[model samples]
Target: MQIIVFIKQTFDTEAKISLDASGKIDAKGIKYITNPYDEFAVEEALRIKERLGTGEVIVVSLGGDNVQEQLRQALAMGADEAILVASGEIKTLDEHIRAVILAAVAKKIGFDLIIGGNMAIDDGSAQVMTRVAERLDLPQVNQVTKLNLEKEKMECWREVDGNREILLTKLPCLVTTQKGINEPRYPSMKGIMQAKKKVIRKIKAAELELDLEQLNGDEVKSVWETIFLPAGRKQGKIIGGEFPATAFELVRILHEEAKVV
Candidate 1:
C-alpha cells in the first residue's frame, strides 16, 4: 500500500491572531506548527503502514518553503518521504484552486490511500479533501475515527450528528481524519535526527502542468473583505436575595435590563 498524507503548516491554535491594514491575517512574528487535525491524519497513515508491514507513507503539502518544517515533523513521525508543491506566488488562492493543485499533484504521484484533516484550523474550510476526491474520481469518507484495512477493502467508523456511522470503501479512497482517531506520537531524539537526513522533493505549480490562467485568474467565488477580533465579553451580574424575591428580580432583569424576556 502506498499511502499519502496531506498536511499543512498553520498558526498554532493558542496564538493570538490579528488582521493587517489590507484585511489579511498578520503572520509576522506568529508561531507556526503543523495543523493539529493533520497530525491525526499522519498518525493514522503511519499506523496503516505499520499494520501492513510493507509499503511507503509519503507526506505531501502545498505551500511556500516554510512548510518544509512541518513536513520534517511528519517524517520524524514515520513517513518514508515527502513532497512539497511550492506555490508561494499563489499563497492566497482560494480553496478551489488549492484543491486543483493538490489534485494535480495526486495525479502525478499515484496512491492507494489519501488522508488529510477533516478541516483546517485557520480557515475551517472542510472542502479540500472532498474536492481532491472528486478531481481524482475516488470515493472518500470524512471525519473517520476508526479504520480497518484488509486487502483492497476498508471498514471504518466516522462521526455524524454526534453519533457514529460505520462505512466501507475500497482501495484508492480518500479519508479525512477527526480527533479520537489515534494519539499522535512525539518525535524522539533518533527520529528527529533521522528526519534531518530525509529529502523533501519540491515542485513548482507550473511544473505540475497547471493552467496559467487558473493561477492568475479572477475566478474566486467567495471573498474575505475584512477580519477583526470578536468584541470583549461583558461581565455577568449576580441577582441577590432568596427564593421568590430572587426569581422576580431575575425576571425583571431579563425583561428590562437584558431585554430578552
Candidate 2:
C-alpha cells in the first residue's frame, strides 16, 4: 500500500507574531512547525504502514522552501520519502486550492490513501482535506477519531456535534485525522540520523505545469480584510456580599449586562 500525507508549515503559536502597521500578523522571524492536527494524520499513515509491514509512506507539503524542514521531521517520524511543493506565491487558508493541486500531484504519483490534519491552527479552517477529496472525486472522512483498514476498505469513526458516526469508504479515500486518533511516536535517534540524509525534492508550481494566471482567477483562496489583537481587559474585582445578595447581583448582571439569562 502507498500512502500520502498532506502536511503544512505554520507559525509556532509560541513565536513572536504581532500585528504590523497594515493590521495583519507578520510572519517575519517567527518559528514554523508542522500543522498540529497533521501530526495525527502522519501518525495514522505510519501506523497503517506498520500494520501492513510493507508499504511506502510519502509526506507532501505546499509552501515555500521553508516547508522542507517540516517534511524532514515527518521523515524522522517514519515516512519513507517527502515531496515539497514550492509555489513562490502564497496560498490562502480559505482557498485551500493548494491541497487540491497536491491531490492531483499525488494522483499522478500514485497513492492508496491521502490524509491530512482536520484543520490548521493558524487558519483554523478545516476545509482543505475535503476539497482535495472533492477534486479527486474520492470518498472522504474528516475529524476522524478512529480508523481501521482491511484490504481495500476503510472504516472511520468520527464524533459529530456530541455523537459518534461511522463512515465506510473504498481504497484511495481521503481523510483528516483528529488528535485522539492515535498517539504520535517520537523520532528515535536512528530515525533522526536517517532523516538528515534523506532527500526532500521540491517541485515549483510551474514545474507542476499549472497555469499561473488561474491560481486564483475563478474563486480566491484566502482573504483577510483586517486583523488586530484584542485589547486586554482589566482584572475583575470581586463584589463580596451575602450568598443570596451576590447571586441576585450576578443574575442582574447576566440579565441586564451580559444578557445571557
Q: Could you say which candidate leads in TM-score?
A: 1
Off by over 4 Å in 1: 235-253
lDDT string for model 1 (1-261, tens) is: 899999989999898888898877899889999999999999999999889999899899998889999999999988999999888757356788788889888888889999999999998989989999999999899989999999999898988887889999998899999899999999988999999998899988888887757566764546667677889899999888899999999999999998998
- State the lDDT of candidate 2 residue by residue for 56-106, as single tens digits: 999999877778889999999999999988767544524466765786688
lDDT for residue 21 in candidate 2, whole number 0-100: 82
TM-score of 2: 0.86
lDDT of 1: 0.89
> On a 0 to 1 TM-score scale, where does candidate 1 land against the true structure?
0.90
Estimate candidate 1's RMSD in Å.
2.5
What's the lDDT for residue 17 in model 1?
A: 86
